[model samples]
Target: MTYDPTFDQTRLDQLADQCLADNTGTGKVIFLSDDEDNRLELTSWRFEDEEAKARLMKSDFKLYLLELLDTLLVYRAQHKQPNASRGVVSVCKNQMTVQWVSRAEAERLRDL
Candidate 1:
């Protein structure tokens, strides 16, 4: 068997709810429009508990997911073929690959 990362669906739903708390079911990750080569852009996403997001990001599972996502992001950034879209990402309790799907799709998963 191989090692894989997994995320909790309920936690994700809660996170998304928190992020949209003030904005009414909307969130944004802004990309700067400046030419400063090394300047980092500011971004924001609402989460109920800051620690929760921080903990998730700092987890070993997240580290693994980021590694996987990095490859995909790099490919997408290089090609610029497909437009980026908003969605949710989830992982099964006993699965390897992460599942990236739309909000409706996620709702279906949650219902199941």
Candidate 2:
């Protein structure tokens, strides 16, 4: 499978919409995944309450994110980028940024 930037952007937009719908006050949402693993981690916080993070930990958005991550992993594998061991999708104020990073970077973000 090849990477489709447009598709990724569209998916990210949908995810952001879902997050906002789940929590109208959602300020940011982050999705992290390692290409070598099936785990997809999420970090989210409300604009009004940064201290209260992970509000979406148990939200249904995870299922959507998992499917998106699976597709992204397939594309990453086909592209074969050694340094791109992880995929990060971030949404803030309804804007999305998608990136590929190293395992170390992923771990650091996961810890945040």
Candidate 3:
């Protein structure tokens, strides 16, 4: 997972597309509820000040999140075990943590 705060607005959309493709071959999807993004949303409101722009930016963030959620669903589906364990491809807030989900899958994705 690469994290660059300097990314342009299209970054989230690109992530979304990747998720859609990855999930198609992966597994079943269940969308979890949103968490404490309200505070983050408020902070965003403080930064942009304009509701319209903030709403658009917020939507983009959600699109990326939905993509990630779908990817999780697909990856879980590939597992043979019925008892599912939740995992995440999360980049820490400090952007320093990376826990590889699968070595083979990572390698395969890298080849692409």
Strongest candidate by lDDT: 2
Worst 10 residues of 1 by lDDT: 24-33
lDDT of 1 by residue, 66-110 (tens): 343444334333444232221234322222222334435434544
List of clashing residue pairs for candidate 2? none
lDDT against the true structure, per candidate, is 0.35, 0.56, 0.32
Better of 2 and 3 by TM-score: 2
Winning candidate number (TM-score): 2
Error of 1 at 29 (Å): 14
Q: Model 3: residues >4 Å from true position, as ranges?
A: 1-59, 81-112
Q: Candidate 2 residues 15-58, lDDT tens each?
A: 76766454533343334544255344443332444432345446
- Provide the clashing-pair count of each candidate structure: 1, 0, 1
TM-score of each: 0.32, 0.60, 0.27
Ranking by TM-score: 2, 1, 3
- Over 4 Å off, model 1: 1-59, 85-87, 96-112
